[model samples]
Target chain A: MHEATLAANVLKIVSRAAAGKENRVARITVSVGELAGVMPAALIFAFNALKKETPLDRADLILIKEPVTACCDDCGTDYQPGPFPYHCPACGSRSFRITGGEEVRVKSMELKKEI
Target chain B: MCKTDHNHLEDIDLDCLVQEEDLRHSDRLKAAFRAAGVRGIGLLGSPGSGKTTLLEHLVPELMKKRRVAVIEGDLATDNDARRIQAAGAPAVELNTDGACHLDASMVETAFAELPEPKPELLLIENVGNLVCPVDFPVGEEIRLAVISAAEGEDKPLKYPAAVLRTEGVIITKTDLAPYVRVNPDKMVAYVRDMNPHSRVFLAHMDAAGKLVTEAADGGCSLEDWLLG
Candidate 1:
C-alpha cells in the first residue's frame, strides 16, 4: 500500500543520481527488511506503474530481503526471532532490542548508456 | 565476450533511505508541533479497534484543561469526525478515498482545516489498517498503536512494524478480554518483545461502549500518557 510512496522516492533518488549523466535506467536495486512493512509484489506493481516512459521505464527492480534480527542486551547475541512471544534465544532475554529488519533503501541504480 | 554483453550502462551508488524527503517533511512537522507547544499524537490500528470510541472519551477529558483538535483519517465518510465533534472538540475529516494511509503533507493540510485557536493536543486517528499506517509518520510526535483485545494476542506478532514504529501501545476493550479469551498482559508482552522502548497503556470499556476512565494500569494511565 505504501509502496507507491516508496516507488516515487526511488524515482526521486534515481533522478538525482542520474542527472547530467544517463536517462535510460537498466535496473534499480533496493533492500527491504522483512519488518519494513513493504510487500514486494505491491512495490513491483507500483514501480512498474510509475516508471512508464520515464528514465526508470523497463528498469528491473532487484530486492534484497533482510530478515528481522534482534540483539540481546544481556548477552549481546544477535538472533533472528520467531513468530510471537519473541525472546533472545541465547539468554532468553525479552529485554533485547531489534537491531535490524526495518530498512527500505535504494542501494544502487544501473543506467543504460548509448555507447 | 560479446560486444553487446556489456549491458551495464553506469552504476550509480545511491545507498540512501527511500522517501528521505517524505520522512524529512514529517520531521519538520514534528519540530513545528513542538515549537508551537502542540503535541501531535497519531493513533493507528485495525478496523473496529475502538479508536473513535477512545477519542469520544478522550476529547472531553482533554478539553477540560487543554485545547484539543482531531483529524479523522478514513477511506470514506466523516462519521469519525462527527463523533469527535460531538465529543466537544473541533475535528476535521480527511478522506483518503482510496489510499491506505495518511502522510505528513496530508496531515498538514488537515491541520489547517481545524478550527482555531490551535490545539495544544492534536489527535490524528489514522486510517484503520496497521500495515500501511506504520510506515507513514504523519508528523506525530507520539504514536500509539491501538489494539483491541478481541483481536487476540497475535496482533503484535502479525504486525511487528506497528509495534516497532509506535511510541506506545494502547490495548483497548480490555473489559472484553475474558469473553474473547485473550490475555491483555500477553499482548503487552508481545509488544515488549518487538520494542523495548514502547510505553504500554491499558483501557477498559464499559458495557455502553464508553471508556472506563477510572481504570488505570501500572506505571501509566491513558490520561497521563496522552496528556503529558
Candidate 2:
C-alpha cells in the first residue's frame, strides 16, 4: 500500500536525523491528517514490518490524528467540518476551503542519549 | 547498571525534518518538472468512470491547440496508453503492477520516458481508485476528479477526500442517468456541498463525437473551465 512508501520515508528521516549522533531512537511521533488519505493503522503496520533490520527496530511509533478544519471564504469563518457536506455553520455557506487535516509529517521523536 | 538505565531520554523536535529536505520523492519530481517547464493535470476517479474515455476525447482536442502528453496509471495494462496514442498524442503507461495508486516517484520515472520537446500539457490519468489517489500528489499543477452518474449521488459524501481536494469535478456518463436512475442534479449538489470552491461539470459526448459539457450552475463548458 501507499502507506509503505510513507513509512519508508519516515524511517529515512529518522535515520538521517540520528546519523553521527550517539543516540538510539526511543520513539517516533507522527501526525496524520484525517483527510490525508493515510490509514494510521496501515502506516504502523508497514513501519513495524519494514523497521526490522534497521535502526528504527527499537523505535515505538506514535501516531496522532489531526481533525479536518475549514475556513469559509464568504464569511471568513473557521470551523471544524468533520467530513462532507462541509457547510460553514456561521453563514450556512457551502463555499469553504480546507485549512488543515491534509498533512503527514513526523512531528517529533524521543531519543536515548548514550553517554 | 544496565545500558538502558545509563541512557537518558531526550525529546527532539523534528519540525517536519523529512519535509525540510528537498529529498522528498514528490518534491524532487516537482522540481524536475518545474525545470523542464512541464505542467500536469492529475485525473482521479473510480474505474469505469470514463476517465480513459474522457481523455480519449480531451487529448486530441488539446493536441490541436498545444502539445499534449499523457501518463496513464493503471494497476496492469497498456490499454489506456494505446488509446491515448490513437488519439494523436504520445502516451506513457506506468503500470503500478498491483499498487492501488501512482506516487510521484512513479511519475518521475514515466516523465523520463516521454519524448523530447516537453509537452505543454501533461495529463496524468491516475489509477481509477479515488481513495488512495487523493493522498498522493504526483507533481500536478491541477487536480480533477471524475464520477459518473451511474456511480450514485452519494459518492462525494462517501469519498470526501477525493471530491474535496480536487479543483474540479467531472460528472461523466450523463446519458446513462435515466437507465441508471441516478439524479444528476443531486450529484452536482453533493459535490457543491462538499467543496463549493470546486467547478462542477456535467460531461457527455454526443453521437457525433462532439463533447457536450455544462457547468453545474451553468456558464462555461468543461473545456473553458479546464483550459481557462
Candidate 3:
C-alpha cells in the first residue's frame, strides 16, 4: 500500500532533478530504513510501473537498507540487535530513544549527458 | 616497507562517487509545509463514519481562533472541499482518482494553491477509508481517527494500523447514544488496550457549538511522544 506512495515520492524527486539536465538518468540511490514499514519488493514493483513514461524511465533504483538502532536514555547504552527486535539489551526496556531506522532519503543521483 | 598502492588509490580516488544524492525530498517536503506555515491535523475514519460531518461541526470553532486550510482527499469529486468551504475554512480538494490514499507528493501539490503557512492550523480530511491513509504520511502533526458508536467498537482491534498510528481517537455521534448500545467505557478501554498510548475522546456538538467531551474521556498518553 505504501509502496505506491514511496514510488511517487521517488518519481517526484527524480523528475525534478532530471528536468535540470538534458540527458536521461543513470542511477538513483535511495536509503530505506528497516523500520520504515516499507516492503522493498513492493516498492521496486511500483517504481518499475511508474518510472516508465517519465524522466526516470530507464533509471536504475539502488536501495541501501539501513540498520535499526536504539539508545537507552536511562542507562546510556546503545543496542544493535541485527537479527532481533529493538529492545534494549542491558535494561530490556522497550522504552528507549530511536536513533535510527526512520529515514527515507535519496542520497545521490547519476545522470548521463551528451559530451 | 610495503606501503602498497593505497596512496596511489587515494591520489586517484576514482572509486569515490561524486553524485547528487538529494536530501531534497525531505527539504522540499519540509520547505513546502514550512511555506504553508500550516501544520496539518488529519481526520481519519471509514466511509460513512461521520468524519466529514464531524469536521464540519468542529472546524468553525477551531477556525474562529485561527485561519485554517483544509486539504480534502477523496476518490473523486470536490464535495468535501465544498462542504469545508461552506463551513468557513478555505478548502482544496485532491482527487486521488483511483488511488486509495494521498501521498506526500499530492499534498505538496496542494500547497501551491494555498497561502503561505500563517501560523494557522491546517486540517487534512483524509479519504473516507481507513486502510490506506494510515500508511501514508501527509505531514500531519496530529492524526485523529474517528470511530463512531454506530460503527462498532471492535473497529480499533479490527483496524489496529489506523488506531495505533493516531495520536487521538474521536468517537463521533454521541447524540445517538440512546438509540445505540455502545458502552463508551468499554470502547475506550478496548482502544487503550490496542494502542496503549492513544488519547480517546467522545464528541458531540453542543448548543454552544463546541465538541463537548463525554464519557470516560481523559488526556492522551501519547502527548509525551507528540511533545517530544
* Top TM-score model: 1
DockQ of each: 0.71, 0.64, 0.15
Expressed as tens digits, the lDDT of each residue in B1-228 for candidate 3 is: 112143221111111111122223424665666566666677788888787877686677676666777888899999988998898878889998888777667777785677555436777888887776776667677788888877775777677557656778878776666678776666677776545457787876677765665434545422222222
TM-score of 1: 0.91
What's the lDDT for all of these models?
0.85, 0.84, 0.68
**TM, every model:** 0.91, 0.89, 0.60
Candidates in descending DockQ order = 1, 2, 3
Residue-pair clashes per prediction, in order, are 0, 0, 4
Under CAPRI classification, how is model 1 graded? medium
lDDT by residue (B49-154, candidate 1, tens digit) is 9899999998898888789999999999999999999988999999998898999999999998887799999999999998888888888888998899999978
Clash count for candidate 1 is: 0
What's the residue-level lDDT of B112 in candidate 1?
Answer: 85
RMSD of each: 3.2, 3.5, 7.7
Q: Evaluated on chain B only, what is the TM-score of candidate 1?
A: 0.92
Q: Point out where model 1 deviates above 4 Å.
A: A75-92, B1-8, B213-217
